[model samples]
Target: MSQQARIDVISGAYGRANRKIEFPKNASGKHESMSDIFGTNVFSIKKMAKSLPKPVFENFRQQLKGGHTLDKVTADAIAHAAKVWALEHNATHFTHWFQPLNDTTAEKHDSFLSLKTTFDNGLAEISALETFSGSELCQSEPDASSFPSGGMRTTFEARGYTVWDTKSPMFIQDGPHGTRVLYVPSVFISYNGEALDEKTVLLRSSSVISKAALDILNLIEPASEDHPRAQNIYTTLGTEQEYFLVDRGLYALRPDLKTTGRTLIGSLPARHQQLEDHYFGKIPTRVLAAMSEVELELAKLGVPIKTRHNEVAPCQFEAAPIFEEAMLAVDHNLITMDVMHRVAHKYKLKCLFHEKPFKGVNGSGKHCNWSLSTDRGENLLSPSSTPETNYRFLLFLVAVLKGVMDHGDLLRTTAASSSNDHRLGAQEAPPAIISVFLGSELTEVLDAIEENRAVDRAVAGTTTTQMRVQGTTLDLKVATLPKLNRDMTDRNRTSPFAFTGNKFEFRAVGSKQSPAFPVTVLNSAVASALLEIKEDLLKQMGDKAVASEEDILAVIRKYITLTKKVRFEGDNYAEEWVKEAEKRGLPNIVKSPEAFKRILAPNNAEMLTRLGVFTQAELESRFHIMNEKYAKEIIIEAQTLWGLLVQHVLPAAFSYRRELSESAAALKQIGAEAAPEMKWLAQLSPLCSDLEDISEELDQLLNEQAPIEDPEKAAEHACYKISPAIEKARELCDKVERLVADKYWPLPKYHEMFSTL
Candidate 1:
């Protein structure tokens, strides 16, 4: 292609910014306002209350709230309502939406109109009539052979059941493909009821956390500190989604972006988030339009998206929602990501959720703001002024730290993926070492507890210390912006897990990764820690007795002392912290393959199995599945790198080298000065030759046979050898890109992408 043609392609992409597109809507009617459209497609609690009979709705609501099994009568009533509502909204099909082991949702749609016999005229005939019954809604059999099960089910044995999770209300989908789908959130399992998806483990982990929390609550005196003992405790999550957007035209041109979801070999972008001007900056017109569509689409589905802004990278942005129950939040995040992609494409852009699409700037992270709330609206992480509440809060905080201390490797293992490896440990993302940042104010409070120091405001010499960390006021000298109220201490961007005021923000999670596994690991780890604390307290009080207030305080102090190493107040990204973390005995496994190995450890297996999160066999299968996924992903990246280098980069280099050689020879033929051309040829020719040499080396590395039957060994080969060669090939190819002429270069340059959008 000519230089003009490439320029035209980019210009054509930019031209899309001027056009405006309508947001997606249902066929029922046009939506005039958010109130009119909000929850219109969702079969929410409100929808259920209105649609079902009072007693039936109340009993069914209790079942959902209490996590009890639904009776056939209630199931039938709910199914009938759901079918009527779906048909009214023009939905012809429904599917059991489930997250399989691949960290992605899967569904096979079935029509509500089932063919049945009527025998009207004493002749054999088929009749099409609506027939979505309770059994169909409650359970479905989808072929299990295609899904990754780690040998749980043979290819010939393709029987799997999907059961509806009653807690997550049914919702009608929007957009062209979605409009026809009445998506029922569900759990996938094999014929023998082996868990096959992240949701299954998550559901079990949630139960474990809830039960452990209730046990602790039950042990405490009811109605203490003006707070009643909670009947139920649930985990909540406010997931912050981060992504980048590039014009789809440019995305189409780059095979690497399409294949591996990142630029395979491009130079470090010159003008990429360098000045930090893009952070919370003005929204680009095209991006704003895309965000508008995303918001409208999500609003109808009952997703409470509360914030949107320019993130710290060029072409990057973030959208965050209010906290909801953890399971629902996980489902919402998946839906939000999907809706964002669809909306971006509607505006001729491709939403890039890859962790590191460009090399020289900040990578995207989905910061999960996690907390626990009671039935009466008490945030467990929030510090209280009363002695009993404050003590309880501190106890839970200490348990979290202990969990991090004991299970940092497991937490990191949950987040391990080939794509995440590029983002972790640098570029505004977390380091491989996991530590909790409890800010300056919280640090001082913990310090006092650890040292047994009496507080200054010790309630007139009483032992009750006021642990309230006063909120900070941000008075920026701006006219329109109000005087901002902020947390007691400043935010820590470097910490993987940081206490951002009331909740812990897990900032190291990759943008594209699912939160189910991470949340499961976190909740399970915390539960295990809490159980340990309970046991230790009982041992101190008695082998099987509840602790008094004094005894509880002593137990809290002991645990604080034991788990102090997991709390880091300094910069997590600093080199000194890495050394410091090593000294602190923190696990610093940076590679995904090695980090994933921790999941199969005896200690991790025992905790997960004992908590009923996963069985022993299930644990091994997960390890195999993840390692296999990592190996395959790296192979794809390596092969993609090879294709571009051999077919495009090598040819471009040769073209430039030939030009330099011909110029040098032609100058000599003309009997003119040829010193500059010869010098240029001397430089250009060798670099081109070296590019091929590196490409060949990479091919050999990729071609080497490993013990394929051993998934761990195969992943190790990909990680230790193949990945390094791919990087080396990229390094050489990037060097070649510099030598090649702008007109001859076959790939989009970083500067072009960064500067344009």
Candidate 2:
């Protein structure tokens, strides 16, 4: 494109962004009360009660809570009631929504209209009527061969099933032109029932963890006739989603952003998040409008969204939901991402969930705040007033530490992706090394416990620590622990996994990823750890009916000492920590290719298979699939950068250079000085030449890597060869972008794209 055309596009984007935004509304003009709007679109318990018979409703409720298989009769009743409730809300079709092997949601819609042949006066006639059968709701067949199966299914093997996930609530999703569809959360599987999707493994992991936790609970505190114990336990998650917003018009003009979900080549703005003023600053009007609609839509879908605020980067924002069971929370988070994107489009803004959408700024991450709970509403990770005395909590905490210590390498693989590679190890985000950060308070308690010594609760001759906040002395002393705040000491945002108050935040999860994978890995690892602790305690007790507290404490101390290397309470981003982590024998697997390769390591595979979280075939398939995905993503980004450079950047730079040369010649012919034009020419020539050379090198590298047949080898090539070349190309492009005049720059400038909104 020519300089003039580029200028025209930039101006058009500005005009579109400046236009008044007309906010969308539902059938009702304005939003009602929060309580009124909440769960309006969901088929909640109230809707079920109103639609189903009392006995069926109670049975179905029990089945859902227990995660048991629904009988045919119960399935039919629930399906019929769901159909009725959906119809009442103007839904005409239903879909079995499931997360595919890819980290995104997929759905195939079917109209509720069923054609039946009825004889009228002995004549066969076809009539259409609304119908949804139990079989239809229970199972759906979509083409499995088309999805990423990693040699699990061939092209001829097309059968795949999506079974309704009873634990996750069904909801109605609105579409264009008043179209509403009932979405039943389901699990996708191959024909033979080998685990094929994320939800299946996640469900398996949840069950294993629950059973393991119950075993430990029974061991620690024996249940008798007087006190019956809870039957099951489950993990909970609250995902903090961070993303960026840019004008849709500007997004449309940028080829790299359109193709790669990130800006492949753009110079940093004069000021971008450097002042740290965008963090918690007053939100821009257009962004707030989009956010309001997004929250309302999510609330209606029963997504319990509870927080929203500006992030550390300009144009970046975050939205978080309250904690829910791991399975339901995963579904809700996927729904939240969809809603945010749709609502942002309604406001003429493009919501970007890419881990690193822009260069030289804080990247986005979905901090998975995870915890464990019992059926009786006990938070296993929550420390009571005196954590030193809470042996049960200490045991559970040690289980988590053992999980991370044993499988930290595998946990690091959960967040591995080509897109996330750019964000990890950056200044803002956590490093690839997996380390657990327990605050100073808990660290001290654990150290004392390991040494078999009582905690020195009193500091400076007092057990209470008073904190002064703006001349207001907030009494923080709540007991031995001082009622640990969200950040117990200084906030350790640099830790990949940090224990914050009642939960451990897995902060390394990429923003765009489904939390099911990471949470599954976590749950499975912790279950294995918990079972090990239980075995150790049992062996120590020998034939004794009840274990002594000393035995339990000994087992806990053994774990704390064994997993000591995985604990780091200091700055994770510091250079010293990296060297120290190496000395401590922790695996600092930074490259995603290496991390993905370790997924099927003997220890990881054995633990997962032993716990029944994943079969050998499923784990092997994942290893293949992740490598294939990583390689493909990098190649696509490389191709996008090359295209932008060839089709957009180079042409614009050459055109501007020619124009400058012509202007200088004209001035020289008129007997005038052309120093400014000559200076631009001198600065522009070298950058453009170097960019052209790098683009050729990138093209050659892609051609060389095109013939690699093995996914693992291809991934390594992409990571080492293509990835670094892409970075070099990016640097050159950024330099050329800066030298090129604003009007002549092919893509919208960073300052313009960010500030236009």
Candidate 3:
């Protein structure tokens, strides 16, 4: 019956809608313009300007721009306008959408309808009316203990608040049966005002980094009205999301995939990504249809999904969006994941966001293209055409290098998870070691800066020369094709953190995890470094209003020397790089537990606390939560693998062996063709025994208790003991799978799952 499920999926015998999804439509049935459909469901600044009084609207705008606290009067006016806008957009209920520490979004919906008591003459009367107030919009109470607080909150003290983030806009989400709810982006905090969610820390990090950066900028160039220091600096991000599409029916058949989001035990297919033909290949028809609907849904909520294409692995694809502010970009990515999962159902597909869904192929990652920018429209990381302007870029660049060097272990912890463990250090993804790749040309430029020599301007040009003959200057490229303008630097996919063009691409982040933590760490680390640079520059100036060119150059040169060891231009996957990194005193932490231990290290904790990104208690809570989460995931995967081996795989093996033995016995009695059956049984019986032995071993490992209170110890045990046992059992299971009859195999094979769609 399980085999039949795989067959049914291959034969396209599942339920899925066949109708076309017409998005961006008007009442007259004509397709609406992108500008018209964009942000129609969102209570945006434009809507606020139209709904609120002129004075109130200006006050709200100033609060957002200036980062000032909103007064009660202003909050009431803004809340009234937002409520009216949400209702006009067909929203009947509202939800405080927040990101919890478990790498998922959470929400609780409340209706706008309310009953008001009034006296009519001598009798009491009840009237129904819609009401929304500033107090309700600004804060909401949720059970703090219900979420993963890492012992920050106990069950007895179950009180948490969701406060409105004024910067991120509120949008309406459509549900089944014409239900629509207003979603206000919020930050979750405990009763004592400790950050209980990802967004709160991210918000604090943003402010810290911006202030630190602005201080340096003010020292270099006095703030004019056009480029004022009061104007907030922002961290911009472009998240490239990668995912896989599997048939929904086939997904339901695999217990491992359903329980652990990966195939724990499956035989590698003969034709899986070996030819390298799947990358950027033609998109499957059904998958394209699903992506179209997903884009349309995102468009209504103001998500700028700009690109889609096939990724490196078969059945894997990528969806990338245009750059936006850090907070909004994280919010939109969460929305994108939700939309992809919800939309895939209509096409009988399941979107897999696991880091490594398949064992032997490439895994998925969220390539975060991160950079710093100012409200004055200047990209801090971008190099200018002239040598003078490039000095400012070099200062910012050196700050990032120093930041990454000092906090390499802490940065690795941001991407730490059991699922991500399988993906990292693989050929297709960056390794566990944290290193920066600035390409060869940028390395040379930095070298020149450190040596106090002139930088070659042509090396920093945006275009590369066309291909030519080996010994001649004549170009042999196609005459009809135009000259291509490439990026200023070559891309390095093997590095965990690489400078692509103007921004750094944090390629080690797991697809299934939230970008908030990684971004927060990155912001805090760079801010700490920037603050140091500002102090150094101030000390060198010694009461001078402006430092001389020599002083500025000396400061930049000092940083280049301090951070020189972290910049690697070689292959991160190469084994030599690991040994070399150790020689350079760089950490190469391979396990999540080791990485988590550094979160509360003296330097890391001090930086985070001093920057106001997280209190000491908050940082401690995160450490416990990450360790506990890692251990729990490993145990779950182990349990699921054990269940499959005991109930599903071993039984299949036994049935096949019994059938072979009986057939051999019957053939022997008739004196006909018994040699083949006997040989088959001989090969299958020992493997079946070995499979049972290893499964029992795995079961024992599962039963072995690590101290529950010590999460670090428990995580280490799970990583060292249970994980290896699971791998051993998987090896035995795969060996048996090759011998078992196709009809007897219970779970769907890899070939069927990868090729059917």
Candidate 4:
């Protein structure tokens, strides 16, 4: 049969199989009482206002919006309302859902049911006071020592606590097997008040950015006829998620995929992405069914997933959503990832979000498209009609450029991870070096501004046109190209950071990571830049005589000059570019530990602390947390490699060697020249030798696992010592996979996983 015929047959079989799977219908129509249903399963502001007394509700709302602390009385009232809401939703349990130092969400559930006797009859009742008390919302004990702590906590200090976060909403999660619970988004911390979770740090960072953005807006366009009271500005994020789906049975057969979330050893399939047929190709029946289920589940939770299509890599796909407030978007992304796993399983598929699930093929990445916007619905990053005209827009643009230039290392650290280490600098993934792609128009504008030359208004309005011939009809219509807008910049696949239309798309984020970390870092850095610009502008304009629009423009022009070195529109992945970046004195901290060290630098520590984005202690804790996580991930990968070699590869190779020996003997006994069989044995012998060498290396790495005392040193050791050994083992195993008989190979091949679906 032809290849196309075989594909059609496979596709048809999958379509037929999908007919047996039952998917959930949209629940919007079934549930009436829309007003009540809005947050029927959530402990929302409306529920709290109704359940709590008027005075108590007002006090709680003040605390929620004003970022003030909740007193004991207010806490008790809020908890009472939350308990009633959870009970109404059929939730018997509650959990403090927090982001831990491990870079993943964590929770510990406790039942709300308590046995109590009523005056007239024996009955169980949950008290409003108990649910609303400060004690309940403040903290819960968990084993902190087991999580990555970067030497902050030892095995003896196992106590960790989670505190309720008022900024994010509390919602109920419905699960199978009669499990229904309310979850409060919270921040985790050690007993000593040191942050032990990503949420705490992220919350701090968000505040810093918010304040800085407000200050910049106030300075650029302070209350005027066109503008009323100064509006609050917020950082927005739209993370485009990419992943792969393979048959669950095939996925389970591979040890590496099961343990590490990526294939540690695999050879590329012959037909992988060669035809480019899979890129935006027709969706397979089984995959469409799985995606439909995922979208429905995500939509119910208000995820707003807007785009879905096939990606460059076969079996790989992408999903994107419209931009939302950074913090809320991060929360939604976490929920979306969890839902994707559940939905994929229903279709007998497994979703692989790891950055590089397969070697020698395109890896997945989460492109965090970010922008800054005002509460009045204005995108601050957007270029206005007049480049030499829009004074406010120019000020904001210069502030972002300055921030990215001054704190490139901080941005690099945000996207650093063990798995990401393999994905970056390969395929279409961005290189580790951080640079901005502002296209030709913006570059020219900045140059003209620096040279004190007036940028022509007509040049900014000029548009590009392309001749189109559709079905023998020629049309010359005005398409309104990106023009002087930042989107006009050609996208650089190799640059970690690039300006895409009205937002900056951070291409360095890893597939498996929570967008919270990178977005937080970005917000904080940009806030710091805005603060600096505001201070300088205020200083220059303090004299009422000089407080003109030109002064603001002058200050922005100065910023352009200062941040020039950080802007690069060239090839970031090229060796020449690397040399140029080094010559320009930019820090190229590649490894996680090296990049993380910048977080603790004196300038960064003081800047974040003064901005109130992170306390000194919180900043230090994050540095330790990141380093520890990197080390532990490498350790897990190393151990997993050792297991695959001993239990799977060695046994498979020995079995094949025995078969070769038996075949050679049989040929000699038949009085036939066994040269062909002998040559085959010769090829098998070297493979056996390489496998033994790999096994020995893995064993050596495992046996010499001496714990490092220093956090920095430990992370460094993992990157340099442990990672190389793991790579070597993978090399030998991949070789053995190609030579070993398919029946005796022990594990599923890459072709089976990548091509089967």
* Candidate 4, 1-757: lDDT as tens digits: 1224334434643554663433333466443332333334556577677788998888887886675778888887677778777777678788889887665788888877655444535655544422434578666788888776656789999988888888677888767876787788888888787777777767777767777777766666657688775446778899999999988866767778889898888877678888889999998878988887777666546577889999988889999987898888888888878888888887778999999888877889999999988878888887754454566777877777887887788888888888888888885787777888876667777887899886543443334331111101223454664322223445777778887657888999999998887887788778888888887888888864334787787898899899888889888878898899999888777777788888888877777787776777777777777777787778888888888888888787788878888888998999888887788778878877887787787677656655585667778888888888888888878887777777677676767666667
In angstroms, give how far residue 366 of model 3 lies from its true place: 0.6
Global CA lDDT computed for model 1: 0.83
Q: Summarize candidate 3's per-residue lDDT along 1-757 as a digit string, tens digits.
A: 4577667777873344454987666899888877788777788888888888998888888888765778889888887888888888788999999998999999999999999999989899999988888888999999999999989899999999999999999999999888999999999999999999999999999999999998888777765776566467899999999999998888888989999999999999888998989899998778888888998889889999999998988889999999999999999999999999999988888999999999999999998899999987789988654423366787899899999999989999999999999998889889988999986567767877877776554554323242111111234498987656545466788999999767899999999999999999999999999999988899888888876667677899899999989999898999899999999999988888889999998999999999989999999999999988999999999889989988999899999999998898898899898988888888889988888888888778777834466888889889999989888988888889998999889888988888766
Model 2, 184: alpha-carbon shift in Å?
Answer: 0.7
Best by TM-score: 3
| Candidate 3 lDDT for residue 489 | 62
- Candidate 3: clashing residue pairs, number: 0
Candidate 1 Cα outliers beyond 4 Å, as residue runs: 1-5, 17-31, 177-179, 223-228, 386-389, 456-467, 472-486, 540-547
Candidate 3 vs. true structure, TM-score:
0.96
lDDT of 2 by residue, 1-757 (tens): 4446546655765665433433345577863666677888999888888889998888888887775668889889989989988999899999999999888999999999989999989999999899998999999999999998888999999999999988787999989999999999999999989878999999999999999999888887878787779788999999999999998877888888888899998899889888989999999888887888888788789999999999998899999999998999999999999999898888788999999999999999999999999888889998865676688999999999999999999999999998898899898889989999987777878888888786655421224433111112235766555543333344599999998878899999999999999999999999999999989999988987667888788898899899899999888999999999999988888899999977899999999999888989999899999999999999999899899989988988898899999999999999999999999999999988898899899999999889998999999999999999999999988888878777776677788777866
- Locate the minimum summed-lDDT window of 10 residues in model 4: 465-474
Of 1 and 4, the candidate ahead on TM-score is 1
Model 2 stretches with alpha carbons more than 4 Å out: 1-31, 65-68, 224-227, 458-462, 465-488
How does each model score on TM-score?
0.94, 0.94, 0.96, 0.89
Comparing 1 with 3 on lDDT, the higher-scoring candidate is 3
Give every collision pair in model 3.
none
lDDT of 4: 0.77
